[model samples]
Target: MTSKTLSAFLLNQLNELKDRGLYNTIDPLEGPNGPVIRMKGREFVNLSSNNYLGLATDKRLVDAAVEATIRFGVGSGAVRTINGTLALHVELEEKLAAFKGTEAAVAFQSGFNCNMAAISAVMGEGDAILSDELNHASIIDGCRLTKAKVIRYRHSDMDDLRTKAKEARESGAFGKIMAITDGVFSMDGDVAKLPDIAEIAESYDLITYVDDAHGSGVLGGGAGTVKHFGLSDRIDFQIGTLSKAVGAVGGYVAGTREVVDWLKARSRPFLFSTALPPGTVAACIEAIGILQESKQLQDRLWENAAYLRRGLQALGFSTGHTATPITPCMIGDEEKTQRFSARLYEEGVYAKAIVFPTVPKGTGRVRNMPTAEHTTKMLDRALAAYGKAGWELGLIR
Candidate 1:
């Protein structure tokens, strides 16, 4: 029923991806994506999941989800603007705002959607945005959707951001200017120089927006990067994801009451997309409560990361400038990176190869996400796999 030329075109593109070693074949995980994942009747040390605090499989969180489901049924059944805003949703947003140290917060179905909704809602044509070159795909897409003039500054280079902010302000071509950056860059696991960034924003009067997708539950004692540097009151928009450390499904933009009020009134994704199910919203609230009550989970997570980082570094594998727990084992060649990840999987580690387009070409890596749930024995096994794989591939001496 499909046109042959169109089908051929799709097939050819896929073939090109395969030829260039860019095709990603997703492995089917047989069980929960936890510290150890089961696949095809075998277990592998899971170093790929974003469950940094191990809340994804925590029984308290699971129980909360189940109880909420039983009480509220499966779905919210309508967009947020139309009969979908539940009391639990409001509680989740309130807790999110409190956790992020903002006056108010608004939730979206996914973190990607949060960027799309928040960025475009606040910025539009005739506005100008200064964005970090390495900020995330969602950020790039959000800026593009705004129809705003987006100027890329060198990653974490305060000098470049300063220069761009001055130019953008002095040019007098824009109605408004904003500077956006990730609180934590996931690929290299580097924390943004937020204090410096805040100083620049204040001088130039540039609105600050930080997508703290990788920072929440991992940094600032689980508050986030802005709080980590004591700049919680400086940034205009503080964005985070519940799906990662929160171990639930949703994203939020926490800012002033005006910003949240405006988003609720005008943000397209929030207005059009159906609200997150009751279980996710309730579980997310419970996660925040968990984080607020204790930093024990966060402490355990860091201990695990430090242990693994030391082990990997001792094994002569370069884990790049990671201020957080997300570790990247740099493998320069794309093909070799792919092969390295595959060999590690075969040997019981399940880290995924992150190659070109995801990161710059030739800076491919097998990113490791160490969780609180991982035991020392599991990390040891993963290190042994890395050692054997690196030796076989002539990557490490």
Candidate 2:
């Protein structure tokens, strides 16, 4: 097809998305992502970032980044196999392995890439993977790329997983079986039942994978979800991100030393992509150190989450089945949810609406991420705005 025809076809889809209120507009932030952020020249309470610890702008991490940059210069200069793996990367991997209580760890450029690389590296062609239906987009893509038999279990439904596991095993049509789940469901903020899943995996002799992207630095006093449930030793692949609470950019998979060794030799992304910059690696090490040295931040984060949840409930807003700092205020209609989010932004809160494709068609919501850095006063202001938006939109009586 000609470029013009392709553009016309793409624009038609774009217009359809806009008409349905599902087209997202990027809002550029003028300042750092904090409790209060300036975006598009408007100051608003920022509740949309994954920076749960608010360490993205922390002075200590900044200093660490600066120091590493000065010491190592800009980039690693080549792919990992070709002089790209620096001392900083090695140190960060060691720190992460210790932090997550794993035997060893392997770092990748991003959490999504970690999923893409690790899942496909271990479970290819003839293998079968029983994945959670609501697992992240990255996990879905990883499974597809592997060309594995992807059997989806209902979200956190142990019964469904057991049924699928039984069926897959009885068929005897796979080389290996693996079960994967998000340590915490990002949208609903519900935690995965890791202990139960681990037990099932043990019974089926299936490899276990837990993508704790939303659980690290928030659970187990900062050790992550697997350790929170004392399953670090039980789970095979524990994938996590340095970008969220860790306040840096990259991802890592912690597992048996053999797994790390295998990934080093076989993972396509790790072998081809340039390693993380020295400064970014150093910044992550510092972030992990901070998380380990203190539970004060974690405590404060939970306190803020609890306070926000109570406030939203008091206002009669249905804050779905969330157990973490991720709070989603349910508004069924897509347009109404988008309007609710727009009103929130206008009222000085910067939460974005999530609609179809991200969530089920009729279950749109405005997700709120209350951070440790948000003071009680800031949260109170955000609550007031939510109340106003709720009442104005008739979301609550």
Candidate 3:
């Protein structure tokens, strides 16, 4: 039986969210999350996926997953610390370490869990974590899980970070100090100033952590943002997600052997959660191999991003300072942003609106993710839709 008080509270909160245009409505995709997707029996140009290299639907990945599934069955059957550490998992970790230019790596079920596990496992009471103001939700939650003092600096403000780091270090109030940030800020599509961050970390003797979930397979010829700035050896922890550019479902932390070993021994998620499926591990392995073999896919991804970004700007839409493929068409009002997305849907495009909580209030936008699979024709169609929608909604001329 449902408690009336609980039910009333839920109803009130939901009603308030809906009234404020902050409630998100989810639509199920009827087909694969490719360059074009179908929802509710209608196909639309898919500009809303994290499949940066279009490897999600790649034949090689599909084949690899199928073969592994047939050979190893559907599930791993136990947690990683117990009996679930399959050979495929080990191989995937090896490949990940190699790709990230690290000595060792550990995998987790998802990027969120990886952050939750890694951050909490290492940071605790008497320690402090200096985090970016705009770090991902997972990072924020992970920091919360630990008993550490979390200090948030301005988003990508190196000077603010330096000030906080110096204050934290000089006060001697904390035992260990760590500086953490996202390699790419997804909402605004801006890359983090990793070199500057690294310098500050060195000056303050702070441990460096970079969550490169949106940067892997898109920078440094596909090595990631750490490598993009030639700071792979300097950054202490390199976190990435296989679900995005890798086109699989998992996350990993690549670092020195000691750090990886410590995580494997102490991380709660690694000890309690069931391991990733063999098929998924195999697929991830294959994707890394593909990325290592060539830069063609990365090239295509950049080309498509540039094409879409240029088109949107030509249509008089503001795309925030994006240094990578994640392009956001800035629309300030929450209701108007939602309406613009709906208008795009009506015009056969599937760009989703990002609102408050995901981004700050009054900074709502329709985030467009142009992938390697997006052809010129598809981009043209999307641009046309943006033009019409913008003019009709008084967002553009």
Candidate 4:
């Protein structure tokens, strides 16, 4: 299946990655990705998934998915532009718009692809984008795809953003300038300084783009980060992921009706890729409906986060500058951090080690994701495991 030269190149690259400890060896779960998971016939408290609200395994979501599958079949057979757009897809978009308090919305197959679609559709070579330095990889790639001049500013630094915004506006080198940031930094768990970013964007006439993948179900009563800071009317392109808290597989952008229409007409993902399956679309709609109807799940998520964070900190682990539920316990060495994560697995927890280029070097960590489904006892058990791992590794005394 491969030529000799290409095969050699692949083998060499694989060796290089392994030599540098950059190769990732994946561990597949045996069954459902829930509050806990089983691997190699051993159970561990799961703290690595992005299922923040526990809706992924919720009964209502399961029923909705099954019912949609029975009614619509197992697949959506073509691209949205080529007769794949189901009534469920349209209804999901409407629900998404309502949930985000936007005039309209457009869905994509994945959150990563959604960014690629949205950014490239609106920006081009003559334009410029001001991006937060610590923004998600999807955001970075999306900006690059537009062939725009990307200007990086310090993470969550309003002053730096203001300066960069002013420079970009005054450069006269670009036809349009956009300021983009992640609403919640996934690694650090810190919220974006959105209010300040909004004000700066307004002053410089920069288009505002926020990828609120982590904030959709965790903040603003499950609306999003923009709404949390009362900037719903101010943000231009509001992007979110159905896969995260919606317990489904898709992504969306909520904006003005004109923007949504334009994206539908021009966005590559919507134009070329096959539409999300009917069942996923229907389940996504149901999940958003559940969120809009109640804040019970959101409250439980926060309670769990607080309990876990407090427990970890009290046990002498540093949770880096987090404002939300994403808890990253710092371990300075890359190899040691990997070992620490292994120790946690041995101690019966599934928190994963994050290293460069996920985060910068010397800032490697064992990131724990506490979900709403995690009971107090489950959290306590995870904490105990963390304590054991940290102590045995001399990470804590």
Which ranges in model 1 have alpha carbons more than 4 Å from their true place? none
TM per candidate: 0.99, 0.99, 0.99, 0.98
Top lDDT model: 3
lDDT string for model 3 (169-201, tens) is 999899989999999998989999999999999
Residues 1-397, model 1: lDDT tens digits: 9999999999999999999888999889898889999998999999999999988888898999999999998999899988998998999999988888889999999999989999999898999999999999999999989989999999999999999999999999998899999999999999999999999989989999999999999898898999899987899999999999999888999999999999999899999999999999988999999999999989999999999999989999899899789999998999999999999989988999999899999999999999989999999999999999999999999
lDDT agreement with native, every candidate: 0.93, 0.93, 0.95, 0.93
The weakest ten consecutive residues by lDDT in model 1 span 93-102
**Candidate 1 — what's its lDDT?**
0.93
Deviating ranges (above 4 Å) for candidate 4 = none
How well does candidate 2 score on lDDT at residue 277? 93
Positional deviation of residue 287's Cα in model 1 after best superposition, in angstroms: 0.5
> Candidate 4, residues 166-273: lDDT per residue as tens digits?
888898999989999999999999999999998999999999999999998999999999999999999999999999988888999999999999999999999999
RMSD of each: 0.8, 1.0, 0.7, 1.0
Where in model 2 is the C-alpha error above 4 Å? none
Residue 324 of model 1 has an lDDT of 86
Candidate 3 is scored at a TM of 0.99
Worst lDDT window (10 residues) for model 3?
Answer: 215-224
Q: How many backbone overlaps does candidate 3 show?
A: 0
